[model samples]
Target: MAHLGQVELLTPELDATVWFFTEILGLTETARTASSVFLRTFDNYERTSVIVTRHHTSGLRRTTLRAASDEALHRRVAALEAAGRPGRWIDGVAGTGPTYLTADPDGHEIALYHQTEWYSAPAHLRPGLKNQPQAKPRQGIGVRRLDHVNYLAADVLPNVEFFEDTLGARPTEQIQLDSGKVSARWLTFTHKSYDIVYTEDRSGANGRLHHIAFATDTREDILRAADLCLDNDVHIETGPHKHAIQQTFFLYVYEPGGNRIELCNPLTRLILAPDWPLITWTEAERAKGQAWGLKTIDTFHTHGTPPLD
Candidate 1:
């Protein structure tokens, strides 16, 4: 696998969600249809990395990952078929070419694709720096790129195994309960500590989204994001603090449509060593709470998209 490509989030409050992403988060809206709007961050090379779709309930619709190569894409597809988890092919979806759509063990939609339309900024949006994709926006927080996605799964280990076996993702970190059950797992396809994560759903829900994160250039950017969230009446769910697991400086907030969104800065941590050991934390260790010892809020575990009644 290459890297995370795009994620489609379903939101009942479409206008408010789109407003929050474009105006508050500083994403550029590239296109809009009757039911969905495509958005991208300043540094994203692809045409779009997020799709906010109008739906009955707010949650994830699909998670797309770019393949390492055309050959790698076919290899994974063959592996999926051999494992009896075959997917259907989809073509001509706006910025992307052919896509193979499948589901994880918990039924979260997954899309795999190779061909993509690279973003070419028009005159107004062009960046002054030659290396950058588009000009950084003066409005809102201006996050750099889509960071990672977290999913709430009914069975975490099965999903973890599925990702590992099918996509060749490496487990970076995990949490194991006293019962010898893994409650959470973080996996990566690249050098970044975690590109995908699955945490046990306390509500026993399958296919629900935990949160989608966006990366900031610095810790100061996240702090500024917290301030912006407060000023704009966005619901602050948790931190402008550091996580004990990944050690990312983060801020969690609920968009208008009730989907959890995270703003984070990892501050130079990457899984550089190919033989990097998987770090596991016991239940007792996690109970002590976050990096600076702030007790993890109750909602951080139970709160997920398409909220339980």
Candidate 2:
């Protein structure tokens, strides 16, 4: 079911963030109204997009991805009903299949837009940062798209249950550590390895966002994105390492309001089989899978060179 077309972002400052994407990240303003703005990856309608909404409480809100087909999408809808997380299906937008919006316990809404077509268009029509209306964003990073978003829930289990049960999202990688005595967990998604991520960190003022990841198309693009942080004074906490499990290259950038965003690309893709085994790791084995930091943060952070980072 490799039909995830794009992710949507619902933010409080619709107009401001829209300006951020267009002027800063080089996206073209495809459509806009008084309450919302739709940005194309480039000029094309089929490419990925980010939606800015007028409602605001936290910084970033809704996120969406495409479903592989109509049947697959409805199957997911059935799963959602079985799991008791009810949501309404909206008419498909963006030439995407039957779309829907689901809410988390905290009431943050995530939309799923499924494009029924299993096809590709001309490469030029796809969105790229070649002709941005704005020069560059303030903290100017070359982010391709809002790759993944992480959240901090009271317990990630219920949140995990919703995605795994309803959306057919599974943990490609996950870990657990006793949060003192309460048993906390951290997990990653299988769809783009980004379906859902939960951390127990109560460090933020509002306490929802953990981090967001952006996909950089190439190793060169990845480095250029990291450079945006350095050049524009964005606080980069760490990374640009390869992970043994995902085999993807990644780095972290600190944005305003204590939230984090990851820049990543150039990784191997794993196909999900019917009975794909769920591998759980003990702390010891996790360290090994982490490659003792070879393609991970430990290697680069310890080296203090920040070259690959």
Best by TM-score: 1
lDDT of 2: 0.53
Q: Give candidate 1's total backbone clashes.
A: 0
lDDT of 1 by residue, 19-120 (tens): 999889999999999999999999998999899999999999999999978899999999999888969999847588889999998999999999989899
RMSD of each: 0.8, 7.5
lDDT of each: 0.93, 0.53
Clashes of 2: 11
lDDT of 2 at 79: 72
Give candidate 2's error at residue 308 in angstroms: 34
The CA-based lDDT of model 1 is what?
A: 0.93
lDDT (Cα, tens digit) per residue for candidate 2, span 169-259: 6665556543422222333344354445655433322225655665655777667766765766766666556655456677776443333
How many clashes in each candidate? 0, 11
